[model samples]
Target: MPISSHLSQSPEGDTFVKIRFLAACTALAAATALTGCSQLAGSADGPQKVTLWLMKGSASEDFITKFTSSFEQEHPDIDLEIKIQEWTGIGEKVNAVLAGKSKESADVIEVGNTQVAQYIETGGLSEVTLEGLRVWGSKDWLKGLSDPGSINGAQYGVPWYAANRVVIYNKDLFDDAGVKPGPKTRQEWISATQKLDKGSQQGIYLAGQNWYVLAGFIWDEGGELAVETGGQWVGTLGDDKGLAGMEFYKQLQALGDGPKDADEETPPQAQVFARGQVAQIIGTPSQAAEIEAANPALKGKLGFFPIPGKTAEKPGAVFTGGSDLIIPDKTPHRARAVEVITALISEKWQTELARTMSYVPNKTTLAHLVEGNDGAATMAVGAAQGRATPPTGRWAELEGKNPIKPYMTAVLTGQDPKQAAKTASDTISKVLSSDR
Candidate 1:
């Protein structure tokens, strides 16, 4: 998706937002909706409550408190009720609420950017294009965040923040091997890795079943895991382009000591990378803290760069992993919900959030805000080419019983790439094409 120039709210838009907030408060006061609202707001005459569901660890308690205090001060008529949710079985929990099975539903919910398709398929999200595009400059939103939220030209989720994989390398290891820190192209990367893959040092620790990393290589080779055709989705991992990506992965995996049968989580890659022998790992910048915590000895010795692409002109594509804000269709506080989203995505808050969390702001224009932070800046470079997973509600199911991992292990273990890819693609097709 081509990024259009960012559009900002005009003076008139400021008035419109204020009017919308007041109108929502008026409606809430007249309805006196839920008894729960009274308790949450602290009194019957308290501010109109707008409940929000935020995932645990999305923001720090300090950050949340600061934002909540500021937001409440700015909009005195609204009381923001935030509920922290966990990632474990979040899909089923979200489904229950969207299906109206839960006793209480959140007016606004933060969901994984890629997970928006599943919720959209449930027909439980309110359309937010008017606010997203017109009020906020969503036209300039990162495609990785915006693309998944939009399907068939309708928008249901507001892009909040994004994070993409970058090459986290050991500076000490690179110096020992006489290799440069940044390799602009894949061949250069491989050459450097070969030099660093000497005795007692793994050039890179890339788990065989890290399909998210594979997705980026596949995209770099101009292949998609799945694509929509005539209204039905089809898996394409068996295509020639995909096979080429797998070929690269195999070549790269040869330089690592990572296990062929296990995913990165089996013995967490961060822990593995922290042992100080591995030169690089493709991971989010946030994983650095974990790596440091495991071995505090390597605190300032780590370096980062965008993952190398086929060519030096741009960084390799990456799978964007982050959250988006969506309003449930059942929420009576749609107007207030949109208002809160607006406040969060505003340039002021976006910059603050990005700096505080070391996150990539939703807009490409805001990339400069994190340019001073090494990890975040490197991630922002990759975020330009970031892509989300196959935008299908069933994509999650495909992930649940992912055949790609086993297929990767099969190929890495010496099976023919074509045959392995074919088997995985067939499974992907069957899962994505299912109606259940």
Candidate 2:
């Protein structure tokens, strides 16, 4: 999705993605039928047909049509087939295609950045490290998107566009509290929030189970949710740095009236902020629209800044959430597929995509293209320091009934932070280690 697009911090975002995915299936099928299906591999003396599976809404129909025309003009020997897929059952769909179990297969597939690990585990994605380094300057790619696509030292998924969280504030509330807009460091941010938390006006609207925000803080303190030790994944939230991060979270949460046992989606934090009593909230810049719709009076009253870090040097590390492009290992048009992907991620196309969609570019160097947009510009400041969740297939399972949420709730409600973290860490270890 575009950096300007909104995806919830809770499971509701997953639901939204699924709906967009399923809804496009029929539309795409009708288009393919009208155009007629192209041969998968075709003949050696004939033009090669390269199939691409992209998620619905990833790009506009106009963008796709333009790219297809230009790419075909550039390479007359190869024909491109673009298929729009849905997020709903994409994992199973990708697996079936990679395993050669599905009748429809794609040479290149667009998957979530965090999902690369699971697909790599299936032994179906081709390694593209050399191409990423020599042709694309892989070193310049955003850490959040690049790191997850790499396992051990081999790269499976290529970095695409990215989106992360930022501090979205109500300008009127800040002005009334006599506080400034940007806080350079974490301490400065906390101090400013303290001044903003007057009666009936919360400093921030941060729910207790907003673990995505917590992930950034923990990373700022040099902690990991789980780490690999001697060939096994172990949870480390009970570590000293982890607890220190939680302590900071506790301090910040006290400045607001957000629920201790609920997440941002329970009552929808955007709606709460729209009520006009909150000063700030940690969310994607796209939520500003939701807030505006709930109360149109606040349309121009919103502003955004990168999430502050411990020091003034850079923003805190956030969980880089976005999509990645990968190639199935079994594709017959491997060489041609590489050519197509290289074109899409090149500087020319990357800039076009970012500018057209208001997305953070794959490489931080290209971030300047979207500098005119407030939200994309703010998100790019922290894109270099972005991190993804544990690169394990089982990680998605943890999202459902996440142990970290209860641990956060317990610590916020006055339980012993150490004991609560220990319980959560133990569950994380067991879950990551399980096969079924």
Candidate 3:
């Protein structure tokens, strides 16, 4: 049976409407469908078809199609067909397919950064030995980009690209408030925020429920989410460093520097920043473009900087986001897939993708390929130098249960920072300890 046949049917909800809504915002869903189908590349005597599962969206689809077209031209024998699923629905769809006996339909797949660890833990990923890494020469891969896909020294997924967050500040607001151009330390960040806080405009625009952003501060303060003490995943959010980070967020919130309630679905931090309702914002590189498009008047007035750390020597933590390509455990075209992956990560392809998508390429050598594109290069370099968040099997579950953003929201909304941190830590510990 085809993998789609085995999986549960889509819910009766207004799928088309939802997809249209997402498409209007970013063309992400449209890209997924167009690229989900594959086209054969190599000689006609070789394998005729290769099936791939990818997230829905036009950008993803376009990327896949463009890359596949190039790969096909180089090797015309292989034909590729793509299956697209919404980003929000991909996990459940993949899980259902993998749980069933029909694994043949899924040959190549794309997994999100956070979803990768969980999928690996569930044996959803095929094991790729260190020797397999040799196919895609080591020199071409970025260290940080590949680290997330490895578990206990074995590689499972090859990084497609990386997206790191940076602080985007409104220079006009800074100038008006007499704040400095950039913040070099945590203290400087705080002072700048205070100075920028006007009655109608906030000094800082934060999404109250975004734990990923919150984690950067915790990490900047030299804190870990779970410390591996004697081979145990122990909670660390209640520790001194974690508390300090939480308190910083709380102070900002107390001063009306952030939203009282914000979430992945509803918070409009980027929009707020673009409209001059906020002076500073921490967001992905794409956000700069969004801001420029939203408020053209703010073009030269926008300034970019890396998130501030505890000190100059310690770089602030950035939550890395992006897609990665993975071959399923029971794929019939393993060799062909490997060949394709190797080509995709090549310096040539990496450079092209980086240029078109504004994604950070996975190859260190390709870093220079983005020479004039300083923004993307900076994010890529920071990711290479910074530490990644804890990679655990239950990360998604933990995140869902604890919802770090809400805890930060509570703290910012005048709840006890220590208590909120303790509650969040306990919830995360429970989630992590439950399964793998």
Task: State residue 409's C-alpha deviation in candidate 3, in Å.
Answer: 3.2
Candidate 1 local lDDT, 1-436, one digit each (tens): 1110000011111111111123344334322342223332323565576777777666766667777667655666666767777666677777777777877667888888888999998878888876665677778899999999998899988898888889999999999889998999999999999999989889999889888889999999999998888877777888999988988998998899989998877788899999999999988877888899999999999999998999999999998888899888877766667667878888888888888988899989989999889999998999999898878898878878999999999999999888888899888888988778
Worst 10 residues of 2 by lDDT: 15-24
| Candidates 2 and 3, the one with greater lDDT | 2
Better of 2 and 3 by TM-score: 2
Q: Please give the RMSD of candidate 1 to the true structure.
A: 7.8
Model 2 over residues 1-436: C-alpha lDDT tens digits?
Answer: 2233223211222211110011122333432332223422235666656778877767766677667667655555555667777676788889998898987768888888888888888778889887787667888999888888899899988987888998999999999889999998999999999999989899998999989889889999999999988767899999999998999999999999999999888788999999999999988877888999999999989999999999999888888888889989899766556666777898888887877766788998888978888988998897878888888888878777599999999999999999999999999998888777
Task: Say which candidate scores most in lDDT.
Answer: 2
The parts of candidate 1 lying over 4 Å away from their true place are 1-46
lDDT of each: 0.80, 0.81, 0.64
Candidates ranked by lDDT? 2, 1, 3
Q: Quote each prediction's TM-score.
A: 0.89, 0.89, 0.80
Clashes of each: 0, 0, 33
Residue 285 lDDT in model 2? Answer: 77
Q: So what's the TM-score on candidate 1?
A: 0.89
